[model samples]
Target chain A: MRGEAPRGAPNRLDLHDLSLFAGWDPGGRWRLFGEFELGEALVVREGRLRTDQREFDYERLYAEYDLRPDLKLRLGKFLTPVGRWNLIHADPLVWTTRRPLTTELPFAAHASGLSLLGEGAWHGGVFDYQLFVDDSLALDPDRGDRPLAGGAGMGLHDSFDHALGGRLHLLSADARDGLGASLAWFRRRGEAADRLLLGGDWHRRRGRLVLDSEAFYRFGRSADDWGGFLQAVARIHGGLHLVGRYEYIRSADLGAEGGAGLLGLTWRFHRAGVVKLGFQESAGPRVQPDGWILSYGLLY
Target chain B: MARGAYRSQVGLWSWPILAVLLMGISGGALAAAPGIAVVVHDPALAAGLDRASLARIYRRWQRIDTAGRPLVPVNLPADAPLRRAFTQALFRQSPEDMRGFWDERYFQGVSPPTVLASPEAVERFVRRTPGALGYLPDCRTPPDLVVALRLRWPRAAGIDPFGLCQEGD
Candidate 1:
């Protein structure tokens, strides 16, 4: 459940979602995994229930085949492996309630197609890669979450008609520190411009302190966009963290350019549950409006 | 001018104090416990395993061994003293600190190792199941069970192949 209250807006609460996941390993090289979500099940405005906002979302449905101990093949709908955050963006898994604009605002969050993933030890570090392609219409895409840019239909925050991309990361032996890069090329619906996205991310953990950052730029004809954020989480005590982030984003098409600063507290009360309280201040064009946000997430 | 000098002096002293505090919290308890032994099924395989491999197996970073057989690693309950010692020695992390890692793995369809109720139960399970691996206090490992790596007290010194310990620790 999540509750939000902007400085001047009414306090609102909603039952955010219930996610069901299933995985089967048939004792062979083949495996199956699927995720289904019932989202916005209930919404309350000031004090009344809002029925118009309820929705059911199909998040992911995929099958995997183990080509070898170090390599695997996956097919169907899955989260795009652009950066580390998006792969583990579940509310319980991430540090903040607000998603970084750089991770999701520039591209679709999910892709339906095929992917190849592999990992191996190199020197004293580990190397990992994921390459994927999406060439057709997405399956059951939730277009409502995507917002408009300029006056074009399905312009910003929309799925690609065709996309090809890959991400590569090199990490310390313990997987506690790493740096990665991503590159992708795609075309938008009803537009003739070709877009190329370049991204880089890095994270390091030492004792009770962790620092993470990412930057991305999408090159398109008359619609260039770029953004970046650096975040830090320092452990104050058991399960309690002091979180801070600074971010800036610019979109030529929407004529929006701004930055935001956030300070928050995250408490992992249990292994599969987390409660977050964040207060944000933004200048313009924010993904999540500037406000106080309190969210509780649990995995059953 | 005097106040600025005093503030700079305090800032200089804070780092060493904080460093010592962090060290004491992360490693002090493990220094009091006995050594931990990483064990597997085949005795010969013990000679080939290294500290890096053990850390990888437990973290679910490497699911299969060099022979392409799936590795099944087990653990004692989270609160077990021996489990804390092992986690601190291998990953330099507390059980509480690892919850986020396991949660991310859970989201990716990979689960943490199966946890047994006690060290005895872990020993019994590892003895019978092929490709099984587990950790226990050094003295509890019988001759039949193979010791892959012995993480002794004073973890900074690194892996102790001989499994040596003092009378009490």
Candidate 2:
């Protein structure tokens, strides 16, 4: 569960975030994966907690059939396979208490679409790719989609009339070191405007140290904006990790600018469970909220 | 008042204890290795494999072998000591680290290799299944199994394979 309030406000502790995930890949030809999330704050007024802000979200519902080890086709609503963060943005997988702001713009995290994901291996490592297409089916947030994905400027599925996106990711076959680049485009759903996004991400892990970063450039009808985050996690002892992240964003549409430097410590009880506390220092031309946040995330 | 003091002490000590336990579990303290032999069914693919070959094959990175046959890498259960040694020596990952590896791989629509219940099962499966490969403790190599590579362990004779197979042994 997670929640945030300013340093000295009528700080109220309310139920914040919870999720359930189930996946099966029984060493067979078929696989099933899904995620159910309940988020409270993002849907309501920034400071005021309301029941209307409470939302149930279906982040993913997909089934895949394997053509080979390297190739598979997926059907249903899946996380956009764009940058590294969005796909692994579930609470349990992230290192910081608050999400980096760059993940919020351009498109919703959920895309009801189809994807062709495959990989090629060489002496160096494995190179993987994903191709995806989603239609302009303006989904209602109250109807189990992203309730707060519209905070940036548009609804979760309102980006374009239709969309086409793909990613090329390469990592050590062992998954220790990697990098990726993605490109996407879609015309405005009901306007002459259009939006295209170009993104790049990279990560490397050696022994007790891990480093990762992702950046995106937006080409929109009104303004060209950009943002990214660089983060590091160092294992201090056992399951304990010390984490640091620097986030920067320039949102031309929302007029929100600037960045934050965050330092955190986490105790991972499992690969999918962690307790994290972090402090953020806001800076730059424009300012984002600054506060200390505590979060506990679990996956069962 | 006494009970409150004890409760506070428990709370203070619990996390450090858990941390120590996790470190012990993640770090394999077995006899480094237990003399594991890389075994395969196909005669043509029975050559001694290098560290990269083991990494590529077990990771399912390069699926086809030298003979142009599709390769299937089999494993004894996740708790097998040989697996711990292999991961540490070859893949340079602790068992805890491998868990993170698989979780990340699932994000890419990839699954870890198949795990059999026993080393005997792995040996039999590799023997009968074409292009199948596995490893076993050196003491029990069945005649049908072709030794692709032999890996040595420190004090190999003193460490029991079953001891390595036991969880956190």
- Chain A TM-score per model, please list them: 0.92, 0.84
- Name the best candidate (by TM-score): 1
User: Scored by CA lDDT, what does every candidate get?
Assistant: 0.78, 0.71
Instruction: For candidate 2, write residues B2-59 as lDDT tens digits.
Output: 9999999999999899998887876654434347788888877866466566776787
- Per-residue accuracy of model 1 over B1-169 as CA lDDT, tens digit each: 9999999999999989999999998786556556788889866567667876777678775666665667789998888767777887776667776876788878888788999998778889999988889987776677888888898643543445234343234
Q: Model 1 scores what on Cα lDDT?
A: 0.78
Model 2 clashing residue pairs (backbone): none
Error of 2 at A112 (Å): 2.1
Error of 1 at A62 (Å): 1.5
Clashing residue pairs, backbone N/CA/C < 3 A, model 1: none
- The residue-by-residue lDDT of candidate 1 on A14-71, one tens digit each, is 8887888888866456778888888778889889998787766667788987776568
lDDT top scorer? 1
RMSD to the true structure for each prediction, in A, is 11.0, 15.2
Candidate 1: count of backbone clashes, pairs at least 3 residues apart or interchain: 0
Q: Mind giving the per-residue lDDT tens digits that candidate 2 earns over A1-300?
A: 764554654444555776666787554556788777676644233465577667676667888766654576888778777888888776677788777767656555666668887766555566779899876364323333222342423333333456789999987755688899999886534446668899999999988899999899988767788999999999999889999999888877556678879899989977768899888887642223567777787754
